[model samples]
Target: MKKPLMITSLALLAGTFLTSALPDRFIRDQFKKAEAQTELMLAQVAEATKTQPVGKPALVSPRTLTDAGELHMVPARDWTSGFFPGQLWYLYEFTGRKEWADLARQFTARLESEKMNAGTHDMGFKLYCSYGNGYRLTNDPAYKDILIQAARTLSKRYKPKAGIIRSWDHNTAKWLCPVIIDNMMNLELLFAATRFTGDSTFYKIAVSHAQTTLKNHFRPDNSSYHVVDYDTLTGRVIKKNTHQGFNDESAWSRGQAWGLYGYTLCYRETKNPQFLKQAEAIARFMLNHKNMPADLVPYYDYDAPGIPNETRDVSAASVMASALYELSTYVPKSNYRAKADAVMASLAKTYTSPVGQNRGFLLLHSTGAKTFERDVPLIYADYYYLEALLRARK
Candidate 1:
């Protein structure tokens, strides 16, 4: 009996060693697959470009695929419009290919006009992912200008009384002034704006928003609510809601990822220990949750009713993997890198789209929301997958 138990222990140890040792090879293989898929995407984009009206700027950047197996492209105003170009930038960063840089530049140019679009709180998701990466890679002064302008535009959504940025202007009937946990991501743009211009106003606004969110958005267990509506006139909490989760109280998987990534960035920018602690707490909550699948990809909602039968969200996994990679750098004593590697490996092995299929998207099985975009490929999933791969390589 003792010999058999020892053999089982050895087998488990060997399995751990094998899984731990595979990330380098996995990153290479995944990038190779991504390159092939992106090549097909370039051709599709060219074909789509040809059909644009003579005077119109082509708004045909790929977002996802339709239920009929056709590609779904969106305009620059779309929140996800920046991700494909960001993926191209990551490809260039990884492979050092001049062609990828040229293509990235071309696609990134399409979103320059979003600098003045203040309709949404996704300036970071749109402009920062596109122009921010572009500026980081090339030190392009024009990209810097666009990022600064976009940050200024995003600041327009800030409600001083609420001490938070309003997330949705269109949901006026449902929310007086809603601040979503996802808004934590856009604070990165403001932080960058301060760095670019030496203006502390952007920094202060970002800090205020983060502090306010820290006070209001989190559960005692560190799982976050998706949305917190406030009284903009007096900075009072009106209600808390999980607009996209299973219930008003359930944790939305992607929203959790957003908070994890967002708070990590806040700590990076502000060097605030509270933000770092929040990030670690969120990581622990996610990793230690009983419902977390062995592959590390989470269901669309952590508390959704259909546990084993629920849809998996690869996008959330990708975002969390990317955040974990960055967080690992900040807290080298933690197990974040290993966990990130596990998630990335799972995604590489199980979540990637088949070669030259899924309309050239690199990942599959992401749920954009409870009802919409269920079990489909998402552009941001590929974006963060490429990002996590790059971070892993570093």
Candidate 2:
């Protein structure tokens, strides 16, 4: 009788322990909802893209037409052609559909053939999603070579004197050599290229740029500025200003996100304590800001004081969410994980379109190149949004 009673107690104890070890049902439910949402989004994409003409997916807009009877989609003006295949890739992963893979392959081929001869600040978007992802998914050497080539080309743009990659080749002599916070996120492909090719030069340039940014871009409180001009000859930071934000000292939401993720990547790749510390500082600044909304998505600028003028950028939330998840590994297991999980949950619930169909070719609300247009869906937003989802699932 005593033995049987002891066995029963042990069984009860084991059952309780196992139950407690399981993930919270609430979190699991959020993932389920996200999965359902992704499925729905795929359906919508299929419905929308199915009717359109399919030969290499012509870049078209209602406003533009070329003399060659083709819709003229400007290069820098359109930053999302590379992200178009991501929706297809997501569908392929979920549904195991060959058509989706084929479409992804076709998109990758098109991007490779087109090349980045045009001047743009975002080769990472052009190559990472299309070629980097294709190489990861299909193990195609062709895609890998394209990525390697793209990285090599971008690496050439790195100005040793400035210790950072140039942002744009503008008509004005003022911005002939500029560095933007956004370049931090785009430099990962270069790092990856270094890893793949065993070329320290790529990593050297990438790390130098990040180190330069750490010195110049960071504010007193760890918030970041958007753009900084450098002396093309002296490697000196000339000016720091908010090209897209409310003012020079204002905190741009996406810039904060970029710092959070970029520094985290720097830490991961190089294990530099400074990078980790910077990442945490930026994360804390973002987390503690009074201006951010409850959903974790932030206005274009945290310093923007008005109501109607304030605009929430879902892209920032997505990038931060992904960065925080990576950051959790380095941080002690505590509220940080919960914080990261909660941010991801909000992104999955609030920003994710119903059934995942995006009308603007974006998963989140990103104010595209604010200098050019007031607000539009930018391609990198979709790229980062998908990257966060993938990282969260992993």
lDDT of 2 by residue, 37-153 (tens): 444444444454445655555432211212332222432234455665654565456447687688677655656643454466577766675677777778888777777788877
Off by over 4 Å in 1: 1-23, 53-58
All models: lDDT? 0.87, 0.66
Q: After superposition, how far is residue 145 of candidate 2 from its true place, in Å?
A: 0.7
- Candidate number of the best TM-score: 1
Q: Which digits, one per residue and each the tens of the lDDT, describe model 1 over residues 1-394?
A: 0001111211232124223533466567778878999999888778766667667556747888788867778889888999999999999998899999999999999998889998999999998998899999999998999999999999999999988989988778888999999899889999999999999989999999999998999999999999999998999999999988899999999999999999999999999999999999999989899899988899999999999899999999999999999999999878888888778767765676667677688888889988789888899999999998888888
- Displacement of residue 113 (Cα, Å) in model 2 is 4.0
Residue 373 alpha-carbon offset, candidate 1, angstroms: 0.2
Go through the candidates in order and give the C-alpha RMSD of each one to the true structure: 5.8, 10.2
